[model samples]
Target: MFQHLLVPTDGSALSDAAVRTAVTLATAFKARITGLHVMPELHVFTHRIDTLEDTQERYAQLAERHAEQYLAAVARAAQEAAVVCEVISVTHDQPDEAIIRAS
Candidate 1:
């Protein structure tokens, strides 16, 4: 039986489907689920219209908001299934690498 499941989502339809499946499995196994959202690092180019700091700040805020929104799906599914759920978000250049690290 699985003790925990990690579900990474980007708020896409496919990812939402995966979250539902994971929640179902977790409920069946009485396992916990961790929802992970990896936000990509924002690269600021000097040629951009906005200031470098401003751009980075804006990107960070947007990324954080999106991450919360994406992870909420997993949480909601788990809640409906009466399964334990945890959510986390991190910034990384590569999502695959971030997921590996999380595991």
Candidate 2:
């Protein structure tokens, strides 16, 4: 009954199971799958001579890398099941806000 299914993942084992479930559901319904990863903002500010922008950029890079890795795995799983899948990475201070906005 779903045309487009949005699945949020945190790269955890539990989340991996959920991804598998979503992929199964999408395949059954012949629906497109959208995998999302939300990068939570770093809040622990330390005066380590590094600028805030630098810290934020580093965090963003790390988040993007992890998200890509996680989504790639999910995409591969979907592909094996012959399902269409898309991946998206988002950054926000709050997980719920990022997911809502992405949706």
C-alpha lDDT score of every prediction, in listed order: 0.91, 0.87
- Encode model 2's per-residue lDDT on 3-83: one tens digit a residue: 888888889999899889999999899998989988887875677756877887887889889999989888988899999
The sequence of per-residue lDDT tens digits that candidate 1 reaches over residues 8-100 is 999999999899889888988999999999999987668767688788898999999999889888888898889999999999999999999
Q: CA shift at 59, candidate 2, in angstroms?
A: 2.0
For residue 40, model 2's alpha carbon misses the true position, in angstroms, by 1.1
Least accurate 10 contiguous residues by lDDT in model 2:
41-50
lDDT score of model 1?
0.91
- Model 2 segments more than 4 A misplaced: 48-53
Error of 2 at 57 (Å): 3.0
